[model samples]
Target chain A: MARILAVDDSAAMRQMVGITLTGAGHDVQQAADGAEALEIAERQKFDLVITDVNMPKMDGITLVRELRNRASYRYVPLLVLTTEATLERKQQGKAAGATGWLVKPFNPERLLATIAKVLG
Target chain B: MPSSARPFTGASELAGLAPVAQDASQLPPALPGFESFQRFWDRDNGCWMVKILPGEYYVSRSEEAISTVLGSCISACVRDPTRGIGGMNHFMLPQDATQGPNDWLDPAIGLATRYGSYAMENLINDLLKLGAVRERLEIKLFGGGRILAAMTDVGGRNIEFIRNYMTLEGYRVAAEDLGGTQPRKVVYFPASGRARLRKLRPVENRIISHHEQLYLDSLGKQAAGGEVELFD
Candidate 1:
């Protein structure tokens, strides 16, 4: 099972992600916002990082940028989870080195599929 | 889904406003003495509403009533049956005296309070003046989800503020489901004092933008800037 880091500002979203990923047989860790995610990433190795874009005390884009700058995370998969599905934002994420984007309220199957494609 | 099979008129147009239905069998059984209430439709808003009225001779009952609220701000529900009336309010933010009176809600910031405790006190006093007894009052709280994730920590702050306020005021909170990623569509049945919560999936960016615009207008703020990016 892969160790995954899930970050979001909403307690409910974090709980949902933790439940879904753990049920899929992956070990999960959670952070309330991007800043917390950064701190956790520094202390441990994770197979994947799933993050929400809109958060306080730092955001997903900034997290992706910082993660990409680290040598160990250069190729590690990073997926952005967001409510925004705009083409422009997608383009921005791709340019910042995100592996893929998953929209919020995603079906469990869709989330699993995306995880397989990114982490497999 | 065939067009004719859709139950709502203007189903296509109303698609945006459609409510997500969950299986009732999956829910826990209702509490004893609590019956499911009536549901109403607001044609103008294209939304369904439910009301649960208090039962007959419920005066001896010690249970607190619960209600749901969904919006950018807070919803305060006040109940004092001796006065024989209760009401709920939805506000955008803790009142700021300097912001000028809210033209629509009667713009007196002094009339408003930043902390939920102050707000609750004001509400209780009003109810009391209307003949509500302080000792017999009970409250059910809802709403305070962070609609603007980027601009404020108001939702989290509001939740904490309310919880603490209730403790200091000696009011018992009978039931609560708060702090979530999704927007909620809440129903407060004043009569029976039960709140039903339905979690709403995030809508499209276009709709979000529309709602945000409406919110800004209500606050008397200019909406000229480009949409604030939700994430960095």
Candidate 2:
């Protein structure tokens, strides 16, 4: 089981992601936005980070760049999950060191499969 | 496996969201890819209004009211009264005819709860992003009328699910008008936190029940699973 950090402004999204990952036998922690997520990451290490792009305080792209700047999370996998599917946004996330971009309305099974693929 | 066979998941709520209304030229441009919603100026209420159908929710920081007609479905009117940011959602428990009516405690019922959680969470999340304080949120519950007598008491189940959700989430409900045999027309002004609701007679308005039933049926028919590539 991998330790994952899930960040989103919606409590429901966080809850759903938490439940899905937990059910798949992974340990998951949650935060409501990029700033809070950064705070959590400062305290401990995680195998993966799944975050929504649009958020308050700090967005997922900025968080990705910030995490990349740190030594511990330099090579950790960061996935951007959001409703914005524009090519420009994807390029921005990619430039910020995001490993993957999964649009919103994600399937739990697909999400799990992606996690397995990445962790392998 | 065919994607169509997958059951509806909470994330399905994120699909096809768009601005609502016919006079697209009159109102502000539709929010990006959201083309399925309806928004218009309400001369009656003297404000702009957005009407959301089932499986949709709307949030606003501007001075506009959101409206919807409900039968067996539920609409949770949530807002941070201090921030003048609020929204409404219209959703129902995805019905599987195979599951018996008495299976309220069945583990399968988690599907319903998850769907409800998504609806509630999305609205509240947007409000928070708009600077609405979670602690200062005042919620008003409406709809969930038992208009569908032939089917299971979906309305009652919705009420139970929403009530349990609010309690667990630690959000206080300011007022609620729920669970009866009649449909309702609810107009909620998120800016002022004022809700105007009117009960519509069951006999004359079969459309409410028909529309809600169709929505529930569609949810069951749609496949909620899909594949996505994870670019390295």
Question: What is each predicted model's overall lDDT from 0 to 1?
Answer: 0.56, 0.77
Off by over 4 Å in 1: B1-232
Candidate 2 local Cα displacement, residue B34, angstroms: 7.2
lDDT per residue for candidate 2 within B113-225, as digits (tens), equals 64566567667766776788778989999988888667578799889888878876677889999999999999998878899999998884478877887888777533242
lDDT of 1 by residue, A11-110 (tens): 5456556766887899999997799999999999899998877766777888988899998789889988765567887888877888888764323445
Candidate 2 regions with alpha-carbon error over 4 angstroms: A9-12, A54-57, A83-89, B1-48, B61-63, B96-109, B220-229
Native-referenced Cα lDDT, model 1: 0.56
User: What DockQ does candidate 1 have relative to the true complex?
Assistant: 0.01
Residues A1-120 of candidate 2: C-alpha lDDT, one tens digit per residue: 999999987665676678789988999999988999999999999999999887878989999999989999998999987766678988999999998887655446667878898888
Residue pair clashes in candidate 2 = B17-B34, B18-B34, B18-B35, B20-B37, B20-B38, B20-B39, B21-B38, B21-B39
Each model's TM-score? 0.39, 0.76
Interface RMSD of each: 15.9, 4.8
True contacts reproduced, candidate 2:
0.26
Question: What lDDT score goes with residue B55 in model 2?
Answer: 81
- Write model 1 residue lDDT over B1-232, tens digit each, in one string: 7755656533224666443342433233332323453333443333334332211111112222333335444565666655445545444333333343222112111112222323343345445445566567657676666655556555665576666556644677766656665566655544455555777665632454355445544442211111222222
**Among these predicted structures, which one has the highest DockQ?**
2
